[model samples]
Target: MTPSVKKIKLGVDVLIENDFDIIENKKILLLTNTTGRTSSGQLTVEEIQRSKKCEIIGLLTPEHGFFTTVPAGQSVNDDIIFGLKTYSLYGNSRKPDSKLLKSCDAVVVDIQDIGIRSYTYISTIFKTMQSCAENGIPVIILDRPNPLGGEIIDGNIVETGKDSFVGIAPISYIHGCTIGELAEMFNNERWLNPKNPDKSKCSLTVIKMVNWKRSMTYEETGLQWWPTSPHIPTVNAVRGAACLGIFGELGIINIGIGTTLPFQYVGAPDFKTEIINDDIKMLKLQGIHFNPTKFQPFYGMYNGKLCDGFFLTFTNDKNFAPYTSGILFFSSLIKYYPNMFDRGKLKQNSIDMFNKVTGSDAVLDALINKKSINDLRKICNKGLDNYRKLRQKYLLYD
Candidate 1:
């Protein structure tokens, strides 16, 4: 076996080393959580206090709350620490208001991202930037690695009308860029600034990471895996999320929300694994294998019900196309459960949610038109190719 390697130095690490001077004496508001740590595992907030360059007047917590304990979609409350108040960015309001930024001179964002659009952290970043722009505050992003790697850009761009908290920008579902790079894209593209272009654009600075590469996954970096959210319990879960998460939006199947596997398990009470097990096995999906199993979710969709689902295991991290696998799973469900499946049951929320998450109605259109998996993959790949070329200008790492 090869010797275990340590993780690369994070943006916070570099910030403390050299960028501290930029924020010196400024009353700072940190838009981060517990995952913001130094390369040696020290909490970023603690490290910042140690540096003593700027005053951390308060903190802003995102969807999962500061420590990442709150469940998905649940409202969070303020937590007090060291006499400073911690505001809930995920609750009451999703963006910084005058009260939240009171007495603050600048803002610093240092959160770990999984490199997907639907993940709410990036939306929080977008909203934070917008708020800062409106308030004329300079913002700095202590950029972290995009665990999925930056080289693999996939999925369709989110149409402007379909934007939501899950996706505020027009980018691929699995956007392959670091948080810093995404900030740059958001700033330069004027996705948020166009509304108030007359206002002074918020000054954006990105403290880039050291010794990280575009092709390296979190596993390759040898970092301790921390679940970005509650259901995404493992790094392996992140690998499959781009596909599994889309299925969860339909609100019919239980994507292991109440179980240990979350995103790794896909099934419904009426979904008979044996019926399509052979068909799915024949798809020969890249970098993944399937095991038919049954589970009972304690919460979320299909709560307290036995679900006949398949457990997905990724075999090749780099080759797997999650959205294609999702389309395959979706089309397979329609083929086997024509009578039982009901897109109508989802109502408007599910339809809008699906379109927003997948970035368009093309997948649904393909399903409705009875398009073959090969043809669907071809269309999706075309979009991916375009995104890869489009993202070339914003990439920061090699």
Candidate 2:
């Protein structure tokens, strides 16, 4: 099947068109990675280099480094790429230090986000915004679409105590907002304010996407999919990962690092695919199907052992809610095989991580107690109601 071609006017595109007008003759520092590409597959670094009004003084990279050459969880050191001084925001420092931000007049951020609460890119953006605000530097965010679509919000509300790189604030698992919209929320919520510091110090602007709607999925927007991270290789992977990542909290890493479909496949040698299938059938999630299979991962968990499992396939993008779907699957897994699943192996407490991603611990605890979907829905609704009111204040696009 031929993939549909739809032209998306990304936030970077809008920034480029108005570069000469809004930022003429300014020394610009850009925060981007491999996913920050033009509609025609041109890198944002190259585009900024070619712009007449902007001087590309430096490049700032988050988690995966400039070309996404680094492995997950590794720190990136300072390096030279394309003859420019590149700073690693994901390494020793998550935010640009005064030394790095000193050379530029303004900072421009253009990166794609997968919309999951646990993705560190958005947190990186938030920290950068705080740094820029502290140093009295103006920050411009080139907003992109939340590839998972923005109509549906799911999961629990993150609590204050469990904040981490994956989730630094109180938001839903599938936050229905763009990067720009999120920055606005951070600014208004005063989330970046340091202790004993003046609160009125941040300056930020978000260049919103043109012709993008809240209901449009990545496929609907006609934008090409660039793997935001090495593991998230395709839209299907992102959708599946959104659901399967909950397993990580249960100490169930999917297939190894080398596999093409990493998070989509779930199994261990002891896993009973029949049980999983039965639970999934009982739950009756919309827009997805599971196919039973067996495989040996080259690395990571259950390495080099034949493991039985199922691969998730999405039938409709519009009706999918990865976060909620994941919780349901996880609850079922825990219920059916309480002894096999170990929740202690999670980096933070699994309960805490679940609360962080879902936004609250009550729902997960309720699930642990085998709460009905209707009862769970009520718990989720509280967070959604709070998020709706809080989110309304920061929406940049209609």
Candidate 3:
């Protein structure tokens, strides 16, 4: 007989169910997108409004905006929603200004965070916490799962000089900590410290989810895995995101940006698919399979051009190493398409973005230098192990 899955209660649900009085009478601002909902399919904003507990003075949207319809890397303009002032954190300012915080007694953050550091939701949280800390406003984080589960820590720690919007700090590429745990780490570790020592730290209150474990993925939690962004539409996409999303920076290659597969399929119009496919097959990489295919993205890189590439499918999720896999894949591309790769397209900003996403230029250099994937994996593993030690102290769940 199969064991039944345990139902998990989201932090918002728990907060609304028992400790709503904590939010009562406070002038609150919520930082979230469409994914901010309870497991019972109730919208957080609707539930809060219906409860009549806190006075939700405003809403702050991250990269995707309130409805999550905005395109990637596009700046979202501020707008009004449900008679409340809505602020776009992804626009002019990446965080709430002092003027915005003046109206609110506290801010409630309820955004879904993919486990990867390159995703911007955590950066929003980092900025929010910093601003809130400086302004003496409290932060209440309605924590959620780390979609990829917390048990597996992968990739390299970002070096200090390469910080960008995608990578706010020196965490692993896939840090494997929940948003709540991250909040705790950010706060306690002084990761969001204000420049002024005398300024009050943001009083962080993490309303943690009930019955969720560190080993459980989004599916195992029995909670809906709302696409954290436009491209990542399913759980498989999220897994693929760990690999393809990093490769997305290579201008010569297209990581299916405008196609349905998005991060699942990687290709280039000039690619020698058969040769590259055979090369990848020889590596015998575990936990993933590559299939040769052709595609034309309606938008983004190589738009409207038929491109040959491979579709990556994760056959064994647990054994997959996205960062190392990306390095290997990139190496193969470089080797086969040395003249066609046109890596010079990666200008300063693009180079920084690539380094920021992968957490170091070491991976890129290793691939370019034709180092063995084993050597590259070892280098990444050392950094990952160090990060794991740093992250272990901050984990909230088993």
Candidate 4:
């Protein structure tokens, strides 16, 4: 479904309409991609260029390059895009070196995030913030509404320093905050520590949205959906990612990675949903139903292969909790087909990565140990109340 308000101005529009007063007359570097645009559909990079706002001396990008030149998980090399030097945070170095930090007076970040912990765009920004804090450079964040909205905080904080690239900040999987709010929390919470030792904070400027509410989903924000990555093409797809992404990292079943559905489809080749239909119902996620279906992927892991899985459908968005539901869904799968999670048959790196993405070994530990759903749920829900209160301090909108 598509919805448009057309009246809401994005941070880019607010930055431009005011004649770039935010960081005018400064040499700045932009960390953005095709997804960065004004409400009027002008590219943020182009708009910055058209105006004498600040000189965009260079560019940096996350997993997907400036124009999505390569697929996900592949390294992106430094190159020129739109006639400017572009650095790849997903390449040799995940953070900007001192040379690039010194080249620009400030760093402007305007990439869109999917609100899921492992999205990686947030990691690139987090890593950049660390470098900027150490180099004494300022970082500007352009706030965007979280696709999944901001009321539903799910998942656990990343363990002390586990798999930080994806789980960089100590927030839940479905962190309920705007990018700006999250940046504020990251700075305030001392997550900028492990790298800087002394925990230096970057000079931050979050140009907030004019009329955004924490309850407003991306569709309610009245903005068009821009593909954040090749996999995440629609806002509905964002929900799918939140529902199955961390579990998808297991890399066993095809969660529609190469298919048109991306994370929306949850089937594997030669598999049938009937095998575990009862287990899925045991998740107890009211209004959340999985309908069995089949598909052939266009590319990626399950390329041209017919996979059997169910698509997630929501009858009640208000009651849905992405990460909590994701865990239950995963738990149900292992409940019936425990062999699917066998580390002996699975890649060790995949299990290691799953633990990393999960911020702890809790999920895998519980699954391997054959713990009950309630047992795993209690373990996962351990620190949620603490997180809810912690997040309240950084929320910018109601």
Candidate 5:
């Protein structure tokens, strides 16, 4: 074994090895998906069930359902898993109803969060925590790696009153914290905002993973990577989603949703990569660079249309800055595709979505007003310093 490599144990392993005392003698409503598996590749549901330390009364799945066959932005349906009642948390309303809560004594969240704010897994857990708070039920979160490493906080905090299913919390776009750690912050920060002030905080127990350091990327943990969603098939895809996700929301450009390399590429039918490629390179996106390429998406925004863009090249994962490279890339795009960012050109709904994902309309305001790329970058990083300070205490790993 390499001396610098540290083998990490997941929270699921810690739960079992610790004898599952947290959920012992309780009826649990487990919130998990296909990604909720151990380092050894065993499903967390099966392991917890096999331990016989707690009675899993029901299963709660987030965006992609039990099998993760569901597509992005689509609602998942409730299904039966192992003869237990399974409820869908990605339906019309994300929170569980009173009847479902009545059936379980506690809520357990074991989903793998990729640490991006726009990703819906965190939102599901956030809403679940709210429900648990109001019902006086405790929530146990099986913590996992942040994937982007817990050291990198990117983008700006979602501004006040900009909360949505995607921007559900006032967190940075790439919040460098685990689901368990975020739960701690959520509870302490009183972001749950339950109907009753007294019930505003949920009792959250975080079963932390062993050997997980803030600076260690998911690959360094020496664990297998499971696609958090259909589009994020690999670690690089996750990075792509962080950097290029905004473009997807605008629908003005194709961000590789339909291709096998979803979120890994960006372009339009008339993007003219040659005109913009050199400028993008000049930005000197740290740890990453790109070369012009083209592809025809089978479906999605640019279905059956060939797009002109570049594929990402990462020289170093540790130094790869998703937010810096992403916002700067968008800034560069605005200069070339000025009309695309025009308020008149963009749909109001799409504009609203972009604002929600970014947590503010500052970027949109800057873009529409013909602001420089540096202006847009400043807007993107507006509250980053304060957010880092705010998130300091909630950090669970070094």
Candidate 6:
């Protein structure tokens, strides 16, 4: 029999070790959610509550609320839960006010990120850092593995001036860096000075993960999976959504809130599965295959109607580049179904949101102009180069 490998400790471990030293006699605020857990499935909030030297002052939550109960696009408000005043950072106001930061000496952030640009959790981290910087508070980040791994880069780079809650900055769709590494990049390269306008003020410290490699996926880490958002129910959903998410720009709605496969299926009463399946084959995407099938979503787009489409299945995660997979899927859909693929018919919100998530207008333009997937590949590569240069300055791993 083969011996089981041991799971490595994440950034939370490092943060706990240094918690007494850094947070001694100080009031600390924790920015986290229900998914923020230690190797043994212990919550960060529970750990901090029992700490001897640290006083946990409050909680700051991102989209989906602290427990991750709220669905996507829903705003959360301030409430008291687990005996602490929890502030909704994902509410109508995305940033923490000065009043919220006034009582905290330092803020500890520990959120699991899905290695995608539009996930919104990373932007919450950025906003928290900005708040702490302005108020002269320090931020300590408990880093975790980028579940999609750290070596692969995909999709087009987000263009400047299109920053939103989804795509917060100019980064590749599947940014290969962890949340901590991204914070470092945003501060150093992007010049996000949290404290003084004339001087960089946000003091940041990252608790690095142990035995985590750039090439390993979440399964390799031996960590239990938790849905970072409501739609991404499984690891496969993460992989498939990264590809199918491209169709979001085309106004093809996934089974709305009620369906099990949120971003995995696309449906319209008039939709044909054969067209999408053929496009998938033409792209020659590796490590995955698509199966054309029919589904009737309980709610959301094309509800109560049998919709035709395929669910993406990955044969090998190692070779799957989700960002490329997504672009190829969208580009192929545009090429084959020119009549059904109406560039003008797509909602303005969809175009803006997709562009924001993708980080540029080039993708929409390419699909509209019937540009080759090769053009998207080139754009993806350019974004990768830029990200690589910026990411090196913040890496804490060997």
Say which candidate scores most in lDDT. 5
Cα lDDT of model 1 by residue, 289-376, tens digit: 7789988888888888998988888753677677677778778877776632355655778777777777677776677677888778
lDDT value, residue 309 of candidate 2: 78
Query: lDDT-based ranking, best first?
Result: 5, 3, 4, 1, 2, 6
Candidate 5 on 1-398: residue-level lDDT in tens? 24687778888889888888888888899999889998889999998898888899889989888887788888988889978778898987799877788778899888888889999999999999998888888898998998888888878888888889899888889889999999998899888984468988988889999988887767678888888788888888888888888767788778888998887778888887997988987887786777699988999888999888888756545657687687778778777777867788788889988888888888778767878777766777888899899899899888
Q: In order, what is each prediction's RMSD in angstroms?
A: 2.4, 2.9, 2.2, 2.2, 1.7, 2.5
| Backbone clash tally (model 1) | 0
When summed lDDT is taken over every stretch of 10 residues in candidate 1, the lowest stretch is: 1-10
Score candidate 2 by lDDT: 0.76
TM-score per prediction, in order, is 0.92, 0.89, 0.93, 0.93, 0.95, 0.91
Give a tens-digit lDDT track for model 6, residues 44-151. Answer: 888877876788888999998887878877888898978999989988678788887887888999888888888889999888887777787889888898877887
Better TM-score candidate (1, 4):
4
Cα lDDT of candidate 4 equals 0.81
True-vs-predicted CA distance for residue 380, candidate 5, Å:
0.9
Local accuracy of candidate 2 as per-residue lDDT tens digits, 1-398: 12453456888788777764566789988899889987667888888787767788888999878776677668988889889889889888899998778888999888988888788899999888888878888988888888777776776667667677787778887788899888888887788765626643478888888878786767777778888877887887778877777556546546334466877787778777887788789887877777788878877777787888777778655657677776677667776577434435344566666565555567656765677776755665566678877888877665
- How many pairs in model 5 have backbone atoms within 3 A of each other, for residues 3 or more apart or on separate chains, i.e. clashes? 0
Q: Candidate 6: where is the Cα deviation over 4 Å?
A: 1-4, 17-19, 194-201, 253-258, 267-270, 315-319
The worst-scoring run of ten residues by lDDT in candidate 4 lies at 1-10
> CA shift at 316, candidate 5, in angstroms?
3.3
Q: Candidate 4's residue-wise lDDT over 1-398, tens digit each?
A: 23443366778878887889978999999999998888767789999998976798999998988876467789988999899999899999999999889988999989888888888888898889989988989999987878888787788778765756877867787887878888888787777865566646888999888877666767677788889887788887888888888877677677777776677788777665886776676566864678888888877667887877787765536667777777777777765566877868878888988888888888788877778877877867766788889999988887
Name the lDDT of candidate 1: 0.80
Clash count of each predicted structure:
0, 8, 0, 1, 0, 3
lDDT for 385 in candidate 1 is 64
Off by over 4 Å in 1: 1-7, 99-102, 301-306, 378-383
